[model samples]
Target chain A: MASLIDLANPTRFMRLSAVLLPWLAAAAAVLLVVGFYLAWFSAPPDYQQGETVRILYVHVPAAWLAMMFYSMMALSALGTLVWRHPLADVAQKAAAPIGACFALICLVTGALWGKPMWGTYWVWDARLTSMLVLLLIYLGIIALWRVLDEPSRAGRAVAILTLIGFVNVPIIKFSVDWWNTLHQPASVFRMGGSTLDPSMLWPLLILAAGFTLFALALHMVSMRAEIMRRRVRTLTILEAERLDRLAAQGAPA
Target chain B: MNDLIAPLGPHADYILGSYAAVAVVLVGLAASILRDHAAQKKALAALEERGAGRRSGRRAS
Candidate 1:
């Protein structure tokens, strides 16, 4: 088993991810299928919301993933700035769009769920607004990557931005508790214990796990592609330098 | 199909629409990543084929 430090090397990470991704993808697919089946057929509808409650299966997972990925990026940002881990910036860059997509899914699904239950598609509540802010922060980090042009420079700048944006995470989590919001407070992970019934909770848990594994698989592949892209950039620069030398020598004239 | 959806009540569209949207976003995300991976791999292979080797003398493959 390679140590964590050893896996930080891009080549090693690529080799390990290639071996693990297929198995990870297969397991995620299985779990998702089972979870969806149970959610649709086995779980009872909410007494108040009825069938609209079914949306919770997908909505909760997307919302969890959206926050989870941002937290991971914040850690990766720390690795880039503090430890200067080689693969840290690559991981952060690759995760941005993915996190943004999950956030978008969360918002859209929450709206769909909200309409039938809350009588409206949206509210300017703290939780929803903070979640939207998180998504915007992700988009900003992604744009920063493109604008910088140089990888190392972009990495440092985005790392700072990511750490600053992390302040919103706690606010998003505690927003409902601190304020009278339309969104419900934490049910599954409260300090007193989960208030959710086991029947519904099981499906939600399984689906969350499945989505997490799927996102990790996607992240790994994206990182591998980023590594290859950097390699291409290096080789192109080397090729250009060689042409410059050849021109200086006037050998090909 | 009707039998399956009938149990969802009058707001079946909302429920079904949520799931459908999730499916679309996830599928789109996966496709984009895979396409990017392929493109990068192809570019690296092409560059190496042109004798533009890495400074460390390591090939990506």
Candidate 2:
């Protein structure tokens, strides 16, 4: 059993991830299949929303993942800035696009779910607007990552930005509570316990688990790619330097 | 077919469309990550093949 510190090594992380990815992917696939089956076939239609309530299966999970991935990124940022963990920035860089994708899914699905229920596809409500702002923050962080040429410089800059942007997470969560919005206040997770019936809650929980596992698998794959990319960059620079040194020594024409 | 979607009521399009959108986005995300991993792996392999050692003087095996 390797310690967390030992696993922080890029090479070790790569090996561990390679071993873990297949199992994670397999588990995610199975859970998603079961979850979808339950959501569509087993769960009954809502009394109020009717079949449109089916959309909650995908919408809620995507929304959860969008926020969850950002929280993970925030932790990774802390790892980079405070502890200087080797894989921290790699994790953060790999997560940005994935988190952004989940945010996009959340927004699109929410809109589709909204149109039939709320009679409008777009709303300027607190929750809806806050979620959109989160998507923008994700895009901005990604843009910052691209604009910086050096990985270390980009890592530090993006870490600062990610920390600053994290203020929106709690706001997004509490927006419905704080304001009279079309979006319902937290139903599944609340202080007095979930308002949802057990039948509906089961499928939602299962689907959320499936989505989370799938996202984590993707994150691991992306991190492995980032590590390999850095290796390629280092080797290429070394090769160029080697050639230059040989030329300077008059050993090569 | 009608029986299956009938339970989804008149809002069938919204429900089905939401699922479809999620599938597309998730699939696209997976494809892009796999593609990036392949490209980086190939590039790293090429560099190692060229006898380019790591900064720590490690010869990739």
Which portions of model 1 miss their true places by more than 4 Å? A1-3, B54-61
* Model 1: fraction of native contacts: 0.92
The DockQ value obtained for model 2 is: 0.72
Q: How badly does each model clash, as a count of residue pairs?
A: 0, 0
lDDT of 1 by residue, A145-217 (tens): 9999889889999999999999999999999899999999999999989988999999999999999999999
Cα deviation of A70, candidate 2, in Å:
0.5
- Superposed by TM-score, candidate 1 places the C-alpha of residue A134 at a distance from the truth, in angstroms, of 0.6
Assign candidate 1 its CAPRI class: medium
Per-residue alpha-carbon lDDT of model 2 for A25-107, expressed as tens digits? 99999989999999988999899988888888899999999999999999999988987888999999999999999999899
For candidate 2 chain A, the 10 contiguous residues with the lowest summed lDDT are A1-10
Residue B26: error of model 1 in Å? Answer: 0.9
